[model samples]
Target: MGWLKDDVALITGGGAGLGLALVHRFIDEGASVVVLERDANRADSLKRKFGEKIETVVGDVTSYEDNVKAVETAVERFGRLDTFVANAGVFDFFKPLSEFEGPEISAAFDELLSINVKGGLLGARAALDALIKSKGSMIFTVSNAGFYTGGGGPLYTASKHGLVGVVRQLAHELGPKVRVNGVAPGGMRTSLSGLKATNTADESLETMEGFEELIIGITPLRMSPTPDQYCGPYVLLASRENAAPMTGVVINTDGGLGVRGIMNVCGGEDLSA
Candidate 1:
C-alpha cells in the first residue's frame, strides 16, 4: 500500500517543474490531486494526462479567489482535502541588488514576493477550514536559498526566507489540527522562469549554461537531482502514518549542502582506497 492511500491533495503550480512531479508522485501513492495552474495549456495537458484521476483548475496562485477555488474543487470533487502544497513560484534569475535600478528593485521585489510568499499564504488560508476538519497538513516548497546564500538573488532568497516564517508560524497556530512544514530542494534543471519586472521573464534555468555541473560541483553529494527525486520527502510529510508528529519542520534535501566541508565539498572522495 502507498503511504498516501486515498488522500486528496491540492497543489498550486502543478502544471510544471517540481509541482508536476509532485502531482504524479501523489497519484502514484494512491492520492487524488487537484491542480491550481495559471497556464491554460498546462492545465489542459494535466486533464488529458490524468483524466478523472485528477482535477485541474485554471487560476493564479497570487489570487485569493483562485486559491479558494482550488480548495473548493478538491473538496467538491474528492470529498476532502488531505494536503495543500504551495508550489507555485518565480525566480529572480540571480540578479543582484547592485544590478537593478531603484524602481526596478522595488518592482522585482513586489512581483517575486507576491507570487512566492503571498501565494503560499493565500493557499494556506483557503485550505484552512477543510484541513482543520480533516486534520490535514500544509507543505510549502522552499528553496536552498531560504538558508544559505548564492542560491538566488536578494528577492528570491528573501521570499523563501519569508516562507520559512510562514511554515513555522502556521504550524504554531494550527497545532493538534493542521500541520505546516516546508521542503527545501537544491538546484535542479527545471524550466523555473524569472521575473518580468527584471526583464527576465523569458529566461529559464534550464537554459543556463553549466547549471547541472554547477550544482554537482558545489554540493557534497556530487549529483544533480531531478524533480521526481525530491518528491519522496513530500510523500513522507504528507503521509499521516509516517509524519504524525512532524510539524514546523523544513526538510533540506539539497545534496548535503549543510555538511559540506570548508576545504572540500565532500571528504570521502578517495575513501575507497
Candidate 2:
C-alpha cells in the first residue's frame, strides 16, 4: 500500500493484541515503527520478526520518562515521528458496580485509568514536538464503550469515554500543526487483560467464555472483527494524504454500534453473583 511510506510511528503496547496488529499493518504500508512495549519478551519478538523495520523500546506507558524514551527512539532510529498511537489498555472484566468494594473500586479505577487514559496523555505529550515538526497525527484506540454502554464495566467505560474527549481537545489545541483523531472499535477475541486490583490481571479476553457470542449478538453487524481488520482506520488517520483535512474526529469501527438500538450486554443477571 505504501500509504505511509517512510513515515515513522511510536505505538504503545505493541507487544500483543491490537497493538501488535497495528505494528504489522503499519510496516506493511511502508512505515517504520518504534514500539513501547513493557514486556521484554514481546519486545524481543518484534525485533526478530520485523528486523530493522521496527524499533522496540521496552518501557511502561505510565511513566513519562519511558514515554519520552519511546519518542526518542522513533526519531533517533527512524529520523522522524509521524504517528503516535496510544493503544495500551486494561479491561475491568465486565465487573459491575455491585461487584466491587469501596476501596477496591478506587484501586481498580486508579490502575485501569492510569494506563488507559493517563498513558495516552503522556504518550501524546512526549511525541508532541516530533508530530508538530512533521505535521503528523495521533490516533487513540478507543472502544465501543466510548460512545455507548455495555462494552465494559464502569471503570473501563469511563476511560474510553474520556479518550474521546482527549482526541477532541488535543485536536483542537494542536491543530494547524499536528492532527489528532481516534478509532473506536468493538469487542474482539484478543489478549485484553484486566486490572490486578480486581484480581483479574491474569484474566484475558481469550479465556472468557461466551464473549464472542455475546459480542456477535450485541453488534448489529453480527460479526466480531479481528485486530488486523481494525487497522485500516489507524492507517487512514495516519496517512497525511488521506486524512489531511480530518482532525478531532473519531472513526467508529464498532460493527454498526452507532445504529444498533438499546440493548443489554449481560441481560438481567445478578451482576454481584
Candidate 3:
C-alpha cells in the first residue's frame, strides 16, 4: 500500500508548475487532492485529467475565504483533510533592487508577499481545525532562494526567506497536534510567472533561454530537474509514519547548493578516474 493511502490533501496553485506535479504524485501515492487554482481553464483541465479522483477550486490563494472554501471542500468531499500544501508563489525574474523604482518595489513586494507569505498563513489558519483533528501536516513549497543568494532578486528572495520563518514559527505554534514543515527545491523549468506589479505576469521561466543550463551549471548535481522529480520530498514529508517527527524542518532539495566549492561547483568531477 502507498504511504498516504486514504489521505486527503488540499494544495494551493495546483493547476500548474510544481503544484500540478504534486497533485499527480499525491494521487499516485493514494491521496485524494483538492486544488485551489486561480485560473479557470487550468482548474477545468485538472478536473478533466483527474476526473472524480480530485476536486478543483477556482480561487486565488490570497483570499482567506477562498482558502476556507477549499478546506471545506476537502472535508466535505473526502471526509477529512490530512495535509495542506502551501505551494502558490511568483518569481521576480532576478530584477535587481536598483532596477525597481520607488513605487514599483513597494507594489511588487506587496503583490508577491501577499500570495507567497500571507496566503500560506491564511491557508494554515483555515486548515487548522481539520489538521489538528487528523494530526496532519502543512508543507510549504519553499525555494532555493529561501536560504541562498541570487536564486532570485531582492523582492523574491525576501518573500521566500520570510516563508522559511513562517515554517519554523508555525511548527512551534502548532506542534503537539499539527506538523508544519517545508521543502526548498532548486531551480526547475516551469511556467512559474512573475508579479504583475513588475510587469512580468506574462513572462515565464519555461520561455527563458538557457534556463536549464544555468541551473545545471550552478548545481553540483550537474542536472536540471523537472517538477515531478521534486514531488518525492513532499511525499515523504506528508506521510505520517515516515515523517512522524519531522516538524519544523525545511528539507533543502536544491541539488547540494550548500556544498558548492569555492573553486568548483562540484569537486569530484574526475570521480570516474
Candidate 4:
C-alpha cells in the first residue's frame, strides 16, 4: 500500500516547483491532493494533467478567505483533511537594505512576510480543527535559508527564519493531537523568475564562479539535489505512522549544506587564509 493511501493533502503554491513535486509524489503514494495556486493557468494545467485525482483552486495564499476556501474544498471533496502544506512563497531580488527606501522596504517586507509567514499561519488556522479531528499534520516549505545566510538575501532569509518559528510554535500549541514540522531545502533549481533581480541559480554561479564551490566542498555528499528530492521529507513528515514522534522537527534536507558556513571568499580566494 502507498504511504499516504487515503489521505487528503492540501498544498499551497502547488502549481509549480516544490509544490508541484509534492502533489505528484502524494498522488503517487495514494493520497488525494487539493492544490492552492495564485496562477489560474498553472491550476488549469494541473487539472488537465491529473484530472479529478487532484483539485485545483486559484487564489492568493496571503488571503485568509482563499485559505478558508482551500480547506473547505479539501474537506468537502475528500471527506477529511489529512495534511496541510504551506508552500507558497516568493524570492527577494537580492537588493541590499541600503538601496531600499522606507516605503520600498515596508512593501517588500509586507509582501514577503504576508505570503511566507502569515500565509502559513492562515493555512494552519483554517485547517486546525479538521487536522485535530483526523490527527493530521502541518508542514511548511522553509529553506536552508531559514537556518543560514546564503540561501537568499536578508528579506528571504528573515521570512524563512520566521517560518521556522511558526513550525515550532504550532507544534507546541497543537501537540499530541496534531503534529507540525518543516522541510528546509538547500540549493535546487526552480523557476522563481522575472518578478525581480534576485540571483538565479546559473547567474549566481557565473557572478561568483565556484559559488557552489564552498557548499559542495563542505557537504559530506558533495552534491545539490533537484527540487523533487525534497518531496520525500514532506511526505515523511505528513505520514503519521512514519513521523509519529517527530513533532516540532525541522528536517534540514539541505544535503548537509546548512552545516557548512556561508561562503565569504572574494575573487575565489579564502580571505581568512
- Model 1, backbone clash pairs (residues 3+ apart or across chains), number: 0
Task: After superposing candidate 3 on the true structure, give the runs of residues whose Cα lies further than 4 Å from its correct spot.
Answer: 265-273
Where model 1 places Cα greater than 4 Å from the true spot, the runs are 265-273
| Candidate that beats the other on lDDT, 2 or 3, i.e. the better one | 3
Give the per-residue lDDT of model 3 (tens digit) for 1-273: 488999999999999999999999999999999999999999999999999889999999999999999999999999999999999999999999899988888889999999999999999999999999999999999999999999999988998999999999999999989999999999999999998998899999999999998887777777799999999999999999999999999999988888867634544463324
What's the residue-level lDDT of 63 in candidate 2? 99
Spell out the clash pairs found in candidate 1: none
Model 2 score (lDDT): 0.93
Off by over 4 Å in 2: 262-273
lDDT (10s digit) by residue, model 2, range 1-273: 999999999999999999999999999999999999988999999999999999998889999999999999898888999999999999998899998987999999999999999999999999999998999999999999999887899999999999999999999999899999999999989989997899999999998999888877776677788999999999999999999999999999988877766643434332234
Determine the C-alpha RMSD for candidate 2 after optimal superposition of all C-alphas.
4.5
**Collision count for each candidate, in order:** 0, 0, 0, 0
lDDT of each: 0.93, 0.93, 0.93, 0.82
Judged by lDDT against the true structure, how good is candidate 1?
Answer: 0.93
The better-scoring model by lDDT among 3 and 4 is 3
Cα lDDT of model 4 by residue, 93-172, tens digit: 45567777666677677777788899999989999999999999999999888997767677888999999999999999
